[model samples]
Target chain A: MIKATNLTKQYDNGFVAVDSLNLQVNKGDIYGFLGPNGAGKTTTIRMLNGLIEPSDGSVTIEEKEVKSENALVSKLIGVLPESHGYYNWMTGREYLKLFAELYGVDKKRIKSRVEEVLEWVGMAGKADILIGQYSRGMRQRIGIAKTIVHEPSIIFLDEPTLGLDPQGQKDIQSIITRLNQEQNVTVFITSHLLKEISEICNRVAIVKQGKLLEEGYLDELIKGYRLVLRNENPTLEDIFFSLTTDEVGGSI
Target chain B: MSSLIKKEIREHVFSRKGVWIFFAISILFSGLTYSFISVKELSLLAQVEVNMTFMKALIGISILVSIILGSTMVSGEREQGTLESLLLTPLSKVKIILSKVVGILVFWLIISVISIPYFYALTYGTNMLLTILSYLYLIGLPLVISFSLLSLAFSTWISSSKNATLLSIVLFLVTAIPMFLSTTMKKSGFAHLVDLLSPVSASMLTLKDWLVNRLGFFFIFMDSLPVLCFLAISIICLFYASKKMDFLGGE
Candidate 1:
């Protein structure tokens, strides 16, 4: 579980990336964070993951402070950065094993765990190939595999499906679904694909200009939006455009 | 921590570039040693002086290699987009910096090992091997490590590896100014001040005292104090820079 209170990040140039934002991600929930470009989504993720210090307020993971380098907080959460990079020299299996060791997986279990995560992300067959030679989809799968190598309770995936083909996108979406439904792992994913989020995420939060526009259960939010628009059926894309657009009347 | 160190070594020191660097240094020492013993005019110098020259060249090359290694350690990771994942792990920033320092140490060790045969080849008939090795480990190691640490601190603060390396090279050349001064310029007040303050000069002075001048241990230790102080300052600067070490790298 994660909680952020009055979180704010303002650059010295007087630009606020995230302004007094608050968010809560419960255990075992697939929470999709949606925002347009430069909407402060990645900044919020970085702050929550403790990769960067917030200019104001704080974040706590399972009641532990997230700002400092707390091993417990690190153990509880895994993160896949938006522009994730890999060591081209390392094979997929070696990469996972290295992360497993860094995450403090038991020495005896590291081998099995690496294999298991490789299999989980559907990278077992290509596990021994150098990352440099792999396709983008394969690299993305390995990236996901690295995050769960140590069995973190929660994983933050920033644009996991970016730059992937339709099949690759589907593969990643299924992996997210399996992780949440079968393994009961919490997923906090960010993306521009509202349709994909609608398919997999049970809860969603939409933000624009560093401020939260909407936050609630997907179905409840949709139902509320449908009533407001006087329409019986409306897609998440419609709701996303409605909330994020600056027009007096939303495009929907 | 060991995993981080191993990763650092594999990524930086155990790669193709690392192998080439080692190979080139080996060839350089071989040629230098052969020229020292066989060249008619050069071979006329005393064996101790030859040994001293070899040691100086070894330390100079070692300092350059260490600087290159340190200058890219952090910024290289940032450029490659690997620093964030490493930071996300439980490893503290200080430990990350320490792991990189260890990687540079491993590089210095390899350079030290490669110079051994050359040292033996030149100091074959004399008791200079022990003295040369002493200077290598004592004055050379500390000075080389200090330069690398100072560069590592620069790498932590600078985002671009190219810029960090360039800045570190400038610093290296500045400290090496005393080495390039003429005998007359060496006696000038400014040169004297730089020689006393610069760690490179201090280490060189310490080595000359022990090897050529054959000064007492107390005098050598006093000469080496500036080098030790430089090492301490570099260590402090590196850790202080590590406190502000971020995923973005630059200030």
Candidate 2:
């Protein structure tokens, strides 16, 4: 389980990227972090992964301080950032192997695991090609493979399908679904794609301008706001549009 | 740490630019040695001048290559967005920096080893130990120092690899200007000061003199101390950089 308590980040210029944010994610849960661009989704994820120090507050992963640079924490969590720029010189196989070794997997297991992940991401045939030659979609696939090579209990995927084609997006969606349901991994995903999030996320937290506007199980949130007019029935999309528009107009 | 180091090495060795840089250094060093040997019956002044020029060129190349390699150390990741991915992994910043340093050092060692044969063939019979020592002192040590420090410092200060690359180039040129001016105006106080501040000039002066005549141990130690200090400073800068890496996206 991941729990963030009063988490805040204040930059030197006095801009609060994250403000007194409180969040909790339980095991086997797919929690979608939804926000527009520059809405602190990335900042919050960075703090969760122990990449950036929070100005105030603390995050605990499995009851251990997230700030502590422990090997166990690294082993337990897999993170795929929105943009993963890798060494262009290395082949996909080599990249996966490198991380496998870092995660302390046995040498004997490294090759098979790498192959398994490459195939899982549907990039097995391109495993030997240098990353520089791969397309953006291919890179994203490799990024996912690298993140899951160690089989971490918790996976954080930031914009995992950012540059993928529709087919590529579907492939990643299935992989994410399997990872969550079958592997029982707690998945924390951040994206601007509301439709995708609505489909896969068990619960979601909508953040705007460094604050959490709403968070709850998807079905519950939708049900709470569901309305039946005597002569008109509004679709979920219409409700979504109205809520966001109302929020923008200074009413939540 | 070991795993990261291995990854660094693999990246460096396979990199297109890294391989080309090594090739160029080898060819340049070999050409300089050939020219030095081909000139027969040279006056003492001429020999010293030629040796000095060769040493300066080696130091300059070392600095250039080091900066090129080190400049992209972290900024490249930021630019490519790979840094976030790496940081998200469970590795510490210290491990990342150390691994990169080790990788660059390995490259330095490989280039240094390759140049040894050329030096051996150039100064085949005349004071072989001295020739090898001079190369190490004058060329190898300064290259390591300048590259390590400037690269680490630039990586820390610059937000993008392109900026770091441009700044490093400018800094290297500026640092080398004093030595270039000193060579033209030989015996001026300005020359001496420049020589003192410039690692290339200092190394050439100390190593060349030591090669020709026996120096006391105390003098040798004193002369070599500055280079050691530069190296120590480089390591410290690397540590500082690791601690200061923001990880979060910065404006």
**Inter-residue clash pairs, candidate 1:** none
Candidate 2 chain A lDDT trough over 10 residues, lowest sum: A228-237
User: On a 0 to 100 scale, what is the lDDT of residue A44 in model 1?
Assistant: 97
**Deviation (Å) of A111 in candidate 2:** 2.2
Docking level of model 2? medium
What candidate 1 gets wrong by more than 4 Å, as runs, is: A248-252
Top DockQ hit: 1
User: fnat, candidate 2?
Assistant: 0.79
Model 2 ranges with Cα > 4 A deviation: A227-239, A246-252, B39-52, B134-139, B170-178, B181-197, B247-251
Cα lDDT of model 2 by residue, B48-69, tens digit: 4555565567666767777888
Summarize candidate 1's per-residue lDDT along B20-119 as a digit string, tens digits: 9999998898899889878999999988888878888998899998998899989988999998999899888899899999999998998899888888
Flag clash pairs in model 2: A85-B81, A85-B82
